[model samples]
Target: MTTTSTDLDAEALDLLRALTGRADAVFHDGQLEAIRALVDDRRRALVVQRTGWGKSAVYFIATLLIRRRGAGPTLLVSPLLALMRDQVAAAARAGVRAAAVNSANAHEWGDVQRQIAQGQVDVLLVSPERLNNPRFRDEQMPELMRTMGMLVVDEAHCISDWGHDFRPDYRRLAELIRTLPGEIPVLATTATANERVVADVEEQLGSGTPVLTIRGSLARASLRLGVLTLPTSRERLGWLLSHLVSLPGSGIIYTLTVSAADDTARLLREAGHEVAAYSGRTDPEEREVLEQRLKTNDLKALVATSALGMGFDKPDLGFVVHLGAPSSPVAYYQQIGRAGRATDNADVLLLPGREDADIWQYFATASMPSESRAKAVLAELSGTPLSTPALEARVDLKRTPLELMLKVLDVDGAVQKVQGGWVSTGLAWRYDRERYERIAAARVAEQDSMLRYESATTCRMQLLQADLDDPAAAPCGRCDICAGVWYPTDVASEAAGRATTALDRVGVEVEPRAQWPAGADRAGVSLTGKIPPEERVESGRALARLTDLGWGTTLREVFAAGSPDAPLSRGLLDGCVRVLKEWPWAERPTAVVAMPSTSHPELVSSLAEALSSVGRLTLLPPLTATGPGSTTGRARGGANSVYRLADVWQAFEVSPSLAEALAGQSGPVLLVDDLVDSRWSLTVAGRALRRAGAPAVLPFALALVG
Candidate 1:
């Protein structure tokens, strides 16, 4: 017999009460509708409600109700580990069993699989990347697709065959859904999807059947959004230093990059605030600990990258301060949604940086798959599967971008990933030129919208909502623009000085390459495995990173495209001198030698000349490239280790005078360059100097390309 609507409501209400631990819990406006669509009608649905609207509840409640009908377990493809943790915990509270298989819990995957086999698990939370795991894809996923009662994709905005989104791998879900039994229900949920994204998702998830799209107001009334245009990073740092404690409660401080997050957290800690840096570089177990600490309000804040964004919950998180604007207004909305979930009010502030556009452009270009790179990768592959490392040797592209392109190509049916590695499917594929261009155009538009959002004076919340295409967009009447500067503006002079000193402190250690990238020999690189200790250059230092908060701005200008080549700026020189003054080398360098640069010859010579003049170290003749590949314009040939090493190997030669100078030197030689990228130039130049008989080589650069 079919379940009645009234009976379904009663069962869903009971599950909701248990899940929320509230005796009188009722569904949000469309939550019950979403559940009924899944459990009753067994239809595919797309949910585009605001973040705190409890999208998880719909899937959890539906899973429980469907399980009561003796259906198989639900398979939840969540985007983040934090989301998985929250879902698993929420399931237990509702007396529904949930298990997870992710990188963090590899040891428990067997137990989770067994639980699922025994009909003990109601929901299985797996990340989108988990779907691509060799074992999971070839072994576990096929079985789950057959047995799973429902498939729910949370944060469905990441699903786009257009090829660039938060998780490009999420496109795999479309294919997975295609293979599922027609009777099984499928649900995709997101709060950030606009009209275009919604259409794309609907097309991907609903191939033949009409998908029920449930969208609610994207506005977050609890969020009082504002923007602060700080002139420099130091001023922004000063603002946070002075005003964090005044914010209502412990909250997140978001940054665009890992370095910024780490730097901001450090500066805040120096000011006596309890905070920690969380990013992709953060260890998996430590990320769990940090998430818990934030949930319990132990740390005053967690300065984080976008890694902490999706579905990480703290009902009372009082504020979110972005040191730099995200790439789009929709992203801004999603991040601010992390705050003010259960509270009547929460602060959302943006400190738009001067480098915001540059940073946005940097990330935007890397994400979209390039047509030429795709062809290059495809050309290098045959019918046989080749490991990623082996392919890296054959292709000039770097590992990360190459992997990302291959994933998109795999989804597009041009390639397939197997147990060994990846193989070309020999299926004729056409590059979606128009689709990629449109996607790029959309990103540009979104970025432009973000710029307007920052400067708009009418209403901050309404502008953000409108950017997300919310029909209910209206003036919040509470933001700094709507109201008048409610947040603290002035940074104390002492705080500014403290921030200046903290952010400006230079000297990033450039660790020497320890081992040659695998498959180097295939590219004609003689080096492989660990470098001989005697031939390796010692750990070196640069004035600062081009992406750093302090001197990075100046260095970026110095090295920006089309910028004129000039001697080192006094500011950078001062920072470099400071690095040298505090240098922790085993012994002071007795000689200074400049690494030849076609890009910034004056800058390199001036740095070497000044350092030697200031320190009274022996000045040695510089080495210059004169071989066949020396005309490769920029010194670094390729991004990957194999190509870079091959391009620079025996590329630079030591002059007689330089060899004589090195032979005469009784101490380490200082090798200065304009910038350090790939580090192959330094390794090659330093090896030449060491062979010519310098006791040690201490490499230094004006900036590191981190």
Candidate 2:
């Protein structure tokens, strides 16, 4: 039976005081009413309020009130590990016992499970992926679904494919919600959802019951918004250096990619500012330390990708500067919302880059799973469970994309991740082609919105507010548009030069393939386990990664569609010479050989000739393409190790003349190629050269695409 005004208002106030550590404290607008909706009416609710608006308070208070009446613990499906950490800490302050299970605390899982079973934890915080854990799903979830007092879905916007950040695992919540007991209240919360996203999330939360949505103004009055259009990374870095100290308390510097974040952090550290890179590549343990460092103002800033966004909270974070704009205005709002939650003023600036769209396009395409790929994955599944690697051997998709597709399929009931691996559920599924097309079109629209945000002069804050469909979308008089560029607009020449020099210094080490991909034997390739050192290429070098801050622009142009394959540019040749000069190889090359490259034969041959001429080494005849599908020296669209290796196996061979030449030489052979994607081509080519009697092979490339 519903509580229906059980009369806990005084106790709720006492709990709020205990939470705030103030003798006299009260609830924010709609907070008390939302609490009543949960504790009294036991209804599903969604609270969309700005960051620091105390959304957590409503749930925490509701949980406490409900528990006082002898209810089970609240299960929170949070989005990030940092969020789990923060939630656990906040629960402690409110005197509510909390426990979290995430990738960072795997060792404590048994303890957490035990505590949950013993009813020692009042609230449980978990990543959305935790819902799909085989053991938990089979053993613990059924019981939790029955007994859970309340369910809280934080960052609920992620549940909607229409949201800027759509998470497949979060889709699993629909099943959980559909199965949950009707009496148990549900709460969904997000600060970043626009109207469409809100409607989607609201529908999901309702399941069958009606959902109560409480939306507050999305505006952050304290943020002074601005955009600075920079032509190059060097100038952007220069601007950051000139103004970082002048900005408010320690904050986050956002970048679009992991390499960009790392590159920015390196340059900043070299400039003597205390900063560190935080991205998806960062270790979970290390990420915790970095989050604390930022909260405590121990570092000037953390250069980060979107991984560091969401649930991270520092009441006094005084600034958020984007090195490049996010693909969507909503995502940008969520990121910048991390700053100025408690303070009266904060600075929010955007440094738009020419490379932003390219990066955006890459992510946009990569995130969408194709219907053909889905069909391929389903065809490979069987009644028997198959681990991801075992499944990869039979499919052409890469590991990441494959796993993502499986997650989507899992939510759709086509497959399930069991204890051993994934198994087909024999459930009929249809690809929602029209829905996906709609989502794709929405993504394009959002991208265009970001473009407008960059160039808009009509109050940046108001524009973001309007994008989120906030009722309070009035203009702020402090934006760059309204105030005539309040922040620094010029970069220091010295700082720009330093950044340029650092980024210009190129040559990333390309580690050789250590092992053949699994399923190679099935593909008619005998390679397995570790590649023998005798047939392996020595550690190689590339002029730059296509994503790097330096030479990447030039490399992108050279590989872009419609770009002609020509001889190495003068700048590329000079870069090659510099890379070789500092390569620190074990031995100098005695011979230079070019890899077969129909698409870039001129580029490869010119690079090989340049290296040979500069080092005064013998220029042997280039390798020849052979075997089926070998007419094109480039790979045959291989997406995984097994497939890539099969395409390249026996694809390149040394001629009788070249074999004889290699047999007589003792020093390492410098093998040149235009690009390296899967590294299988280089590995196969190097093995052939080694078998033909080259002592060692040194693989070099103009760019590394993977």
Candidate 3:
């Protein structure tokens, strides 16, 4: 019972009226009519939509129309197997015969082929990987495509390497679609895209075919964006737990790495929070577990990498937290859109820090190749498939960097992933390994540029929007810096009263002296206290003196103590800054101790060599106890225990305030101990110092002071 265009138009109107309660509602917009004309004129077409837009409706409505006229069927090629299944389920609920081909069953491919050949399946859904099967082309796919009225490519941005979700299999799709008769009317759609992705889709699929660009402005007015920079990830985790405790509803926490996602989930679970995690590495069973849990609201929050956000929509989400920076603006928008779907007033929190920039640089260097390197890899594999070993040998590069180069090539459509190997995509691009390295380096340089943009000191939002070509965007007044902007105020009365306090805080310059300035009273001052003998009081004084001198670099070193190893440990360094910032002013020492690692001949020699290249203040490993006379345990049976103190000092580098307490006292040696059993070693050491007419000797326990 074949029919014509007029018959299809009638059936489409009826189907629309059934869905929306009005017959004429189907074609009221020119968009639908324009899509129909592609089939009417026998031309392939490309359709792109922004997120929250109804691009799916365009194809589904047209499918109803064409099916009524007895067109064979419409087939949807999707990249996400889970999403494909979900879509099929939705179509079936609407009484449409839709089924998806998936890897879940060994017989799915054969079953799909049988169903398609017998005309039992009205709408067939398959992933791009499935399309690469030889059976798809060797059989009657050409006939099936000709009979089909529309060939839909969902989430079309997957074809673009510049897109957040780049799929290598999508590059082969252009060849597959071209094999179909009259080049089946192709409709590709997604919720997100920049100019680059949109162009890639048209060039790859429609190939100059009519492109209907239906742009939608679906900005949710109730959403608020905020950013917080913290000193450590642990502190950020604490803040996250606090946010979750107060906010009710489902939330998504986006992490940059798999370890972060797993660790966050475990940490949240230990805190009595129900959380699920998703990533590319999740096993099939685990993915099923999480998917079911998420759908039923059994999980209150989901900590996931970007891999989880494609088609899982749970409209009740309350917020999105970016634990790391997204790769690009498109990615950021898509991840954040997961929230506020079924609720109003959704909020997004971005926690940015210096660490994120460095992490991104690491990724940029490791994951992507220089453009020239990518080109060179493609050149080596030109005209034939090559195993990884052969490719590596031909490229003459190490396995890891070479593998990464191939991946970047796959993303760029210059190569294709075949079974157990890869082959050039016949794109005619050529380059050597050197060129690829150069290109990869250039890409990293671009990422550095983006880091600079994020750290800009002014107009963050304006700069971001302008980069995206959205200049009309207004300043988000709720941002941290914007909220703190100040205006003139009538505070002359209050200002006069605080002049002395301000002056005291700024301090005064004086010649090096032993005591505080004459007028600077020590009443209520906590800084001047007795100091310990063995403790390095000069190191603490040097730290304070450096701070007084406004040397920002010394703040991290003097207060923050690290083992000679792990110099970049942010926890230890920031903790050091915390101690110095809290030091009381009256405790200032004129002659500070310089216990710089230089005091140790062995350690200083290594440090000197490293400093020649890395600059001063090299963090080195602890000096292990060895040699016949080396002290490993408590000094002199624990009395005035320098061993325990030295160990703690070596590991944590904490300088007890007891050192500062004993400052400026010209007397016998003073000692600080956590515990002591005997007085022999302390008496002997004290006597030896006094025999030499040293300053007075005293002993104090850190535990007692603590």
Query: In each prediction, how many residue pairs overlap at the backbone (N, C-alpha, C within less than 3 A)?
Result: 0, 0, 30
Q: Check candidate 1 and list the clashing pairs.
A: none
Local distance difference test, each candidate: 0.85, 0.88, 0.52
Q: Which stretches of candidate 1 lie over 4 Å from their true place?
A: 161-166, 627-638
Question: How well does each candidate superpose onto the true structure, as a TM-score?
Answer: 0.97, 0.97, 0.59
Candidate 1, residue 395: lDDT = 80
436-529 in candidate 2: lDDT tens per residue?
8898899899999999999996989899999999988888888999888989898998888988888798898989999887788988898679
Taking the tens digit of each residue's C-alpha lDDT, what string does model 1 give over 1-23? Answer: 57799999998998888888899
Off by over 4 Å in 2: 1-6, 627-638
lDDT of 3 by residue, 1-706 (tens): 6557687567656655565555566553445664565456555555544343445556666665556556777888887756765677656654467877667654777777687778777778878766654455446466666677678888777776555543556766776666666645667777666566667677777665556655434344445556666554545566666556555566788887675676667667766788977888898668867866876778887889877777666666777888767756556666777776656566677765434554454455444445555665777787677787666545424465676566556645677767657887787544446744654654454455455445656544444444333425456564434454221212233333332222122211211112221111122222222323432111111111211112212222322335242232343233323433444434321111111222123332332233223322222222221231122222222112222222222222213332443343453232222222222223323333333333443322111110
- Tell me the deviation in Å of residue 687 in model 3: 53
Deviation from native of the Cα of residue 607 in model 2, angstroms? 1.7
Count of backbone collisions within predicted model 3: 30
In candidate 1, residue 693 scores what lDDT?
Answer: 88
